[model samples]
Target: MGKLVTVGEAGEAVVLERLLAALAVPASVSGVEAPLLGPGDDAAVVVAPDARVVATTDLLVEGRDFRTDWSSGADVGAKAVAQNLADVAAMGAVPTGLLLTVGAPSDTPLAWLEDLGRGVAAACSVWSTSVIGGDLSGASELLVSITALGDLQGRAPVCRSGARPGDVLALAGSVGRSAAGLALLLAGGPELAEEVAPELLAAHRRPVPPVGAGPAAAAAGATAMLDVSDGLGVDGARLAAASRVHLDVDADWEDQHVLDLLVAARRLGGDDDPWGYGLVRSWVRGGGEDHALLATFPAGVAARGLPEPFVRIGEVLPVRSGWPAVTVNGDDEVVGGWDVYA
Candidate 1:
């Protein structure tokens, strides 16, 4: 269990203002002693032993990104923290804190916000971190904005521009699960009886990022890394452009089979082919919710201390001028990835 700070106690619009004042502690930074005077006294300060800070933020709109019918306040809260934290992880930084800003209708139950706060607390607990500050406002629909802060621990911050030719590309989580779940959601009705994988639905609702892998990848001297918020094809091309290299993955049906079976089950329940309408494929390649980490490593570099949820996916090559593509083994179906803005 974690501590609870509530709007009911602090009154509306001022809860986060007070929570910021309560998060002070003592710790060490780069071998120097420091106190965590988080989010109070005008601004929070930390021991910048290396004079650097890593940070990122994200926003999710209610209908554009999620719907209350498919998720709970807890799910939204965890996902809000997970996606931002994963960005820090992609840079091989250890996430230290989070600041959340939430907007919802005036008629919203305060308990829902409390559950959301608990979700933030739960996700932070995975990284041994906390939500040090936030802002709340009333709106017509739910909007969650989160900003994550991280520490690099004296290493150069990894960016997308570091992949070299011959680097073995690796991914640190499963793909297409969230996409498969979305296919089930769109094909709704009384016949929607397929049992979606709890984790896959959770992935779409409350994505649990691999928090430890970033440091592990950095320790192993990974060349380039990123969180796969966008489709793999789009992100792959981004990395290619950043590193001046080409990325190629041999498309395997084995992975697609899982997505296929899930969709087939949904169809067997008498739903239409919404999954085949490019929702699942585009999402797996383009969706932005399932915050998995994508990274490149030197060839034959023995990975250390990595757990399940990661696999080697492809390789890097010298940069060439053409559309980056994925080829299905023995088939000529060349599928590119998804792009939000196109």
Candidate 2:
């Protein structure tokens, strides 16, 4: 470990000082109302033209949530933004602005910071959202926090608890690939990794959230919807509880090719419990960071823009008086997900 240094509290520009300098000011945009002493002030006041405000935040820390060696600064920035933005989308809202905070050591490369900024800018541009403001500070490890604001356009906000019995469980993106990529990274199987595609690793490192599916699902008569952040199994359980319905995931129901790829990745990694690592089982139940769209629709309603292989993994059962267990292949199983407090 490196020696710890504490510059006197008297040092003019302490850790927090340089960080603010790096962040500078928010990007220029119109209709944002007057700054009215933003950021560095005691507090900030801004007008919300819409009576409703959609808000979500995510935090990324070095080594725990990400690694510098595995992901570039840009990747980190993009991932951070994507996760929070996805949350807004889950509520069936459109992201309008982001407030980001970054913490890094003084010796961190300037290029890295520039790349991080570029990453944030690129992601914001993709969704047509702007970085309204943020904070910067020095820390022992790199940490990125982003809060996204969204607008619902007077539509009802879709939540997890609205599903009724007989609703159809639907998904909008591929699962297990991110977990598979992580497995390949751990095994260091360059040959097999190539087949998985280095970009797939980006899915784990910097996930491409399904930005369009949220509103589409809502418009398509989705009774309930959520972004699949935690593994499918665990998040599904959450929906089941909120909606007071039992969710049964037919792992056997997924496409053969997708299952085969997951099995192959597991073999390459030599993991005895392939399902536990967020691919077969956990991803089926416990995977996280996918940001895929999972929604429950009223029977007979057609979902729009649902791409190929967007399978109906499960269905909502009536609110029964029993433990909310996810049944897989005829056996009830525990929901696979990380213990945040752990």
Candidate 3:
């Protein structure tokens, strides 16, 4: 949409080759050495040093996962990669390579595609990963799919079912900021205002998942691990169900970031008592897409070894009779987030 440069009459094969070069070359220049056998083959050959490769795949569909009007091609690309990489990290692995597939309409501009490639490369470079291979195709709308591969480095892959009673629940990275940014976009903040906070806008566009915290938690003997792709309440419930334990989140709500969101909501025409009625609190509880790492560690382990950015917010409890999987301040009704079919 910005400074359009169409694919022109170059045809699909030529354009596809150019696109792949644009994506792979920069990553290579940035010291992202590809595998022994890289792209342009029937398939990419990746080495799994520890003999166990953590692999995850995610798809971002236009109008479903993102909107063209609100997000640039680069934003879409980065978001797609972040979500996939976070999944790999959730298994306590270091990401090594990524395979991307992009489908777009014929009329989609070449510049947009180039920007997307740059975004993909930049995202991979953040974690020292390489863009190994991919495919391009024509479609009715934009669709980006990414598959990430990681190395466990001889450590046991952490699973969500390992949490036990008396474990401490901790969060690495932030929550509710993306949802607050989305609320701003929905309230006409981006279009109506000449200036918007970069943090709020970036939160929705390119979420920076806590990549380092996953392995750190694992090394610190974390029992259970998962990324907060969905809202805290929903994902916490999932962890509870998987571990067969009750997660009790009892963090104080007076943090400065939460207060800032409350002020922003009021300015955006939300009720004055956003916190009182659970509107702001709900975002912290049920907001999704942040991709933060939520992990459980044995009591003394977390206190003594869990590193920076990992803050204790809750504790694990034994599964009591007739109790829900997750509860906040002893309340069980706070469960809602992104549901594709809902």
Candidate 4:
């Protein structure tokens, strides 16, 4: 199990001060410019270089979004930052600052908060971003909420609906990894899968999204794009609906993704059953949370070739006459995803 010290030991009064230290960034090391001003006022002041802010926020609560047994405070911290900043990146913008607010029970460990802050600081460091300010409070369960601000630097924000019929659908990173990892954890967990798939645990605990690829696609002339936080079938359909086009995904069981899923099934000690393939298919098509970047490039940009980290996965087609907007191998494939209420 992960190590931690209780908040009771730190005392509620001094918690903020200590946590702030953990959240502080090393601008020199990270290459992220220091904020105009950090914590210590009614509000923090941050610059919007493009004079426009691309803002997005997300909420993660215990039990619903994560389980304490599965992840540590640091993992949740890094994860919270990732999900929000990834939205900023998908807009083809660079994150400049973040506003974080967390609520936790009194029994919650002080180390958890410190680790959470450190996690946020660490992930932000990669994108040259920093957390300027946030709030702390008492609650029955741990709750993490963050709002990320980004700079467009004079480029048009890539929307989810700009894809055209002739555009090429592409993916910057593989999806279903988190799903595969989650499956392994359910089948046996870290102890059982120690030798078989340790990487699966890492994938589930901390997801490193292709934040840089969004900008690269923007530079390469991406027409539409989004982070595959929801499974591809669900998210891809969203993109298709918004762009008024149809998305046909490539489906070849011999594909690398399928092979990877097969590996996970073997770890579960499952025999070669059709049900195993079905589970893998479900994960590949619907298990979102890997934070892969999906985009559509116009034929013009397609001719010159797409950007690095993005490989052609499908093609934009005319919208369905009256049904699903996303398909596989030119036919209908059931769409699934991690909808909060679904």
Could you tell me how far off, in angstroms, the CA of residue 307 lies in candidate 2 after the best superposition? 9.3
Q: Which 10-residue window of candidate 3 scores lowest in summed lDDT? A: 189-198
Please state the error at residue 93 of candidate 3 in Å.
Answer: 0.3
Score each candidate by Cα lDDT.
0.67, 0.68, 0.81, 0.83
Report the C-alpha lDDT of model 2 over 217-296, residue by residue, as the tens digit: 66666788888887777777788888878776665555442564465455553466554334454444555786887888
Evaluated at residue 43, the lDDT of candidate 3 is 92
Each model's Cα RMSD? 5.4, 5.2, 2.6, 2.6
Per-residue alpha-carbon lDDT of model 3 for 1-342, expressed as tens digits?
334366544557766766776676454456766686778899999889999899999989898888877888888888999999889888889888889998988888887787888788778778778778888888898889999999888899989999999999889988887887887777775663224445766888889998878887777788999999888888998899999999988746324337756654565644666343356677778888889999999998976867667888889999987877777767755577787866
How would the candidate models be sorted by TM-score, starting from the highest?
A: 4, 3, 2, 1
Tens-place lDDT digits, model 4, residues 31-54: 878789878788988999898989
Q: Evaluated with lDDT, which candidate comes out highest?
A: 4
- Please list the residue runs of candidate 1 whose C-alpha ends up more than 4 Å from where it truly belongs after superposition: 1-35, 46-50, 189-194, 253-283, 302-309, 325-342
How many clashes in each candidate?
2, 8, 0, 0
Candidate 1, which ten residues in sequence have the lowest lDDT sum? 23-32
